[model samples]
Target: MASSSTIQVKITAARKKTSLLRSLPLPLTLSFPPSPPPTVRDVKTAIQKAHPSFYTVRQKLSLPDTSKALPDDSAVLFDSAGDAELSVGDLGPQVQWRTVFLVEYAGPLLIHPLVYHLPKLFYGAEIEHSSLQKSVYAMVLLHFIKRELETLFVHRFSHSTMPLFNLFKNSAHYHLLSGVLLAYDVYRPAFSAPAVAGTWRANGTLLTAAWVVWVFAQLSNLSAHLTLRALRPAGTTTRAVPTGYGFSPPFALSTPNYFFELLAWAAVCALSGSPAAGLFFGVSAVQITLWAQKKHAAYKREFGDKYPRGRKVLVPGVF
Candidate 1:
């Protein structure tokens, strides 16, 4: 009688396991020892084990009925037992997740400017002669080339792959903007002509001063990035307050890199002598300032009193 009762209990447990598996959404199934509640990380590991293609770092596990992503992968899955059903979605429609390096992003941004500029320089006779246009071209090329090299050797990414779709998005953004800036500032007759059209002259001292600022800002920005990269070692996610060349307080405004970036773009505006370039700088400045504020808040939250309280968000003493 005891043996018979034990066999029936085993059968019931098997049926319960089968039912739980059936209730789970497609392509996701959890198996655990049942003594301890499984964690979101555990589930992610199981999914990766089963799928082999879904890497834990890249995987964005979410509930089936909502778009809100799980915040903490280490949280207990059973804590939200009622909404325990999970689903896996690709980074984009019809596009499976694919890994891309920072260098890949940098390479295209560097090359695209040259690809657009060289033809214009060779074929467009007016642009070929315009020193102003040539100077603008040189600055743009230098900026992107420096970016590419920095991405390759200096910048350390916390996450390895951005969503594959971002490659298309970012490439289009940089390439299209480059085209517009080049078209308006470098190729256009009204903007590129000397002493006749724009307020600033092609070979004027103001343009020379702008070029100086651009070079200084570029070097300063490179130094800032190197300082940031050094805060954490390779393959670690440690965050530390950045210090060095351009970062001494009260000059240590929030995101000194962004401040330097603004300076560089402002130089481009001066070099181009176009209102369009100024507009571009304005838009970029707003965006970078917003990002800087966010970074500042995050630093405060993470480091508490350890983060410098005197640092401004973007501009020192003003913003």
Candidate 2:
């Protein structure tokens, strides 16, 4: 048998060993706080209330108390973390989820059906001749193309709608509508309306040039929108907030593509010999080029050293 003192010594050693084992540190587990979904109204209100400058001077702009950054509640703004890169759709959990589910999915679907049917109905009612109908149909086709792009491509990733994005979308929608109207105005009404008689005929070389210009402009516009749709998808790497200006290739002005579109319109006016078309296209073209230039200068300022210096404004030297 073991001695009592030996037994006690053995028990003490066992207890010490148990204590050491118990004192060993356990692995830590991370617990993330629950994030709630933001409502559409919440996001909208945030944008309206937020500093106007936030909308204006986007690149390299700062927010006060950024450390206490709040969730984006609006359909326009996304709140993402990190400074190196952030995108319009990067807002915190609530805002991000809301954007994907509500704004992006619903808006395009509602717009698409209306866009397609309206042109068809209007064309049948007003355009009588096959040639006139075909031209109007082409305009209608372009409308559907733009709408489909919004639904199939842009809505795929974008949850929140940036102001610049909204502007571009609105402009496109209006431009297409204007084109359709002009076609109808030329074909159906020109004959009946005394003042519009010779001036509105679609056969003039100026009109032909206008049509050609429109076709090329459509191509360029589609290319630009598609390229932007690919790069600025939602949940992608966020860099600067999308001004909807998009990235232009080097050796080109801010939006050389838009400038091409302007020229296309000018050509159309020259070919058509329609004073109305000339006035309308000329004014719109000037406005669009000016807008592109303004946005380009703003971008150059924001990007600083990264911005290309040699790129001209919309037109090479004339601008």
Candidate 3:
């Protein structure tokens, strides 16, 4: 086996398909160690060292044969042979992935409460919200509050940044698509609008059960987040397979955070019965499922047979 420092790799530039940019330069060679391995960031660093303008954010690395881009985080990329090749695409103007996430969540974080509390401005009258409506607002606000705090403190992002245009698109989804729309639906002048499924307020038994379940689900989701955070330590891009409370039987989703988050949202949906809330829940489920699938595949590739076989993508035994 070649020493870690002696493993050689070819870095090829993946240019834009436009004819004007078709005339690309030749590939560059880099030596990496198999022991430590080369992460997507490491390859980007080498490219930047050789070509100053191709910084990390603007660069996308993938296996030579595949166009699917590698995530630029603690992701350790692929196993390398002495002659393995990586294709690096120039993604153009970029911003930190963290920036985009924070900005996106920030919009709804502020907007949800603003519209809920100030009825005169949005509803155009000094209207009082029903007890049920108030409870819905509390749940939604707390959820995003947890998310905002987690993004700032608990969560560790894999990718450093993304295309600049993504900021605008992502913010709109939170601000308008999910945020403003849901706020309007829940806090509208007609207080009855929120009950899309059924009115939990009318049934004390249902209300108690929903709130209790919602609390547990939120805590479970948080436990999953902390477990995931513990996998990657400080000042390094190291990663490992995750395990803990939420990862065990009965709650054994490959990505437990999303599963728990969905569960929490389900409680909210049940209590409010708002179509907008249900729609948001549906969108979140679909998106989280896709993310969970990717993470599951990544865990398989990174750990080989070491990754647990029992773990399903988003659901425990079903999915």
Top-TM-score structure, candidate number: 3
lDDT tens digits by residue: candidate 3, 211-300? 899999999999999998898886556788787787777767678888888899899888777788898888878888999999889889
Ranking by TM-score: 3, 1, 2
Query: Native-vs-model 2 lDDT?
Result: 0.43
Error of 1 at 245 (Å): 3.3
Candidate 2 per-residue lDDT over residues 1-319, each given as its tens digit: 3222100000011122232223211121212223333333333233324333223212111133243322343222223431111112122122233233333334433443343345446445432333333444354345445645555555444333333455444544344434434444444433323433455444556446557767776676566556555655466633342323323343256665577666655654454344545666766776786798787778678778776665667775545
Candidate 1, poorest ten consecutive residues by summed lDDT: 5-14
Q: Global lDDT for candidate 1?
A: 0.62
Which candidate, 1 or 2, has the higher lDDT? Answer: 1
| Model 2 weakest 10-residue run by lDDT | 5-14
Estimate every model's Cα lDDT from 0 to 1.
Answer: 0.62, 0.43, 0.76
Give me the displacement of residue 86 in model 1, in angstroms.
6.4
- Please identify model 3 stretches exceeding 4 Å from their true place: 1-13, 17-51, 61-87, 192-200
Please provide the root mean square deviation of candidate 2 (C-alpha atoms, Å).
17.3
